[model samples]
Target: MRNEKKKSFYQEFEVFSKRTATSPFQHQFCLLAPNEEVAMVMAQENFMRREPVADIWVVNRKHIRTLHPEEKRMLARIDNKDYRTTKGYGYLRKKWRQYEQKMLDEKEILSWGGDKK
Candidate 1:
């Protein structure tokens, strides 16, 4: 005989919420509940009683799929490309100094945007 009561007790529910208008739904934690109604009620006082929660969702864990540990290992790469940044243009500083001119680096360029008419 299938134990319906035991099956319902161990159901894993994933909790999520959106903090604000611009924010995406983020996973807060997991809980065990039989159905969405119970999970939704428990999620409030259980996880976000003291904080602001604009929205919430309770989803069965079995409904979600995620990547494996081995799949994440394929994202590694070496950082040998210094030529893509200002660090690669350090020689320009010395050349500008030889011509009696200040090196107009990032700081000087960004400051130009301050309080313009």
Candidate 2:
């Protein structure tokens, strides 16, 4: 049948685009195309015509990997990274003050490479 023939030739593709070079790519929509080239052309014509696009990505749906609910739960658990943050080391400030010395925090350390007068 005509429907069966078209289904065999077309593949589902997901389109993603970004407004600026530094901006992250966001999902625009999905469409069926015969190949990546056709998908890209179709995506630009359908989605990018109305807005500015810095980049375009056309990925076949089958090639995209996704995490299931169980896998997502594993990644969502608290990661015990508090020690890398200032709040976890708040007591250090008081300790340094007791010694009559200033504590070099993250911001101060990052400014070491900046211009100095």
Candidate 3:
């Protein structure tokens, strides 16, 4: 062993991957390396050794910007906005029953536009 001082080469990195083009990116795992390029290479062998990988991303933990709790509170949304969801339209179901008509929700309506095959 050489009697020399060693630098802190390993840094924290977060990894994300996706299996297909239409799939959303999901968190895989983290790795430690000297830089992002090396981290990516290391992640391929460690995380995706068996499965297929469409995309890969390695983000340095230090470079990631995050908001504080107060900032997150500022972005909080209330559930009172019934008009944004199906809750506001729920009354129509009872009205349809009164008229002896079937009520169609989002899924039923969307099924009409599905592939013909």
Candidate 4:
């Protein structure tokens, strides 16, 4: 049938793009296309018209491997990441004070050139 043939012609694709070179690629949207070439063109025309796009990637949905909700529970828990944060090094403030030196916090680092201290 004509409907069945049309359905077979199109496949689902996941679109990802980034606005800047240093930024991570983020998912834009999903679309149906006959092939990767058409998917790229379609994405370019549809999304590129809205805002700036640094890079674009079109991937077939079938090609991507993802973990199901139940499988996610089997993954290791890594919530303890305070060591990577400024607050985790709070003890350093006391150490620096002993030497009469200031320990620059996040607030001071961010406000470097805004106002004169």
- Every candidate's lDDT: 0.82, 0.90, 0.82, 0.91
TM-score of each: 0.52, 0.59, 0.67, 0.60
Q: Write the per-residue lDDT of candidate 3 for residues 54-84, one digit (tens) a residue.
A: 9988989898899999899988786578788
Give one digit per residue, the lDDT tens place, for model 4 in 7-74: 89999999999998899999999999999999999999999999998999999999999999899988
Q: List residue ranges in candidate 2 displaced over 4 A.
A: 76-117
The better-scoring model by TM-score among 1 and 4 is: 4
Q: Name the better of 1 and 2 by TM-score.
A: 2
- Candidate with top lDDT is 4
Question: Which of 2 and 4 is ahead in TM-score?
Answer: 4
Evaluate model 4: give its TM-score: 0.60
If the candidates were sorted by their TM-score against the true structure, best first, what order would they fall in?
3, 4, 2, 1
What is the Å distance of residue 62 in model 1 from its true position? 1.2
lDDT of 1 by residue, 28-86 (tens): 99988878888888898786776887888889899998778997777665667778888
What TM value does model 3 have? 0.67
Among all windows of 10 consecutive residues in model 4, the one with the lowest summed lDDT is 98-107
Which candidate tops TM-score? 3
Q: What is the lDDT of residue 102 in candidate 3?
A: 40
Query: In terms of TM-score, which candidate is stronger, 3 or 4?
Result: 3
Which scores better on TM-score, 1 or 3? Answer: 3
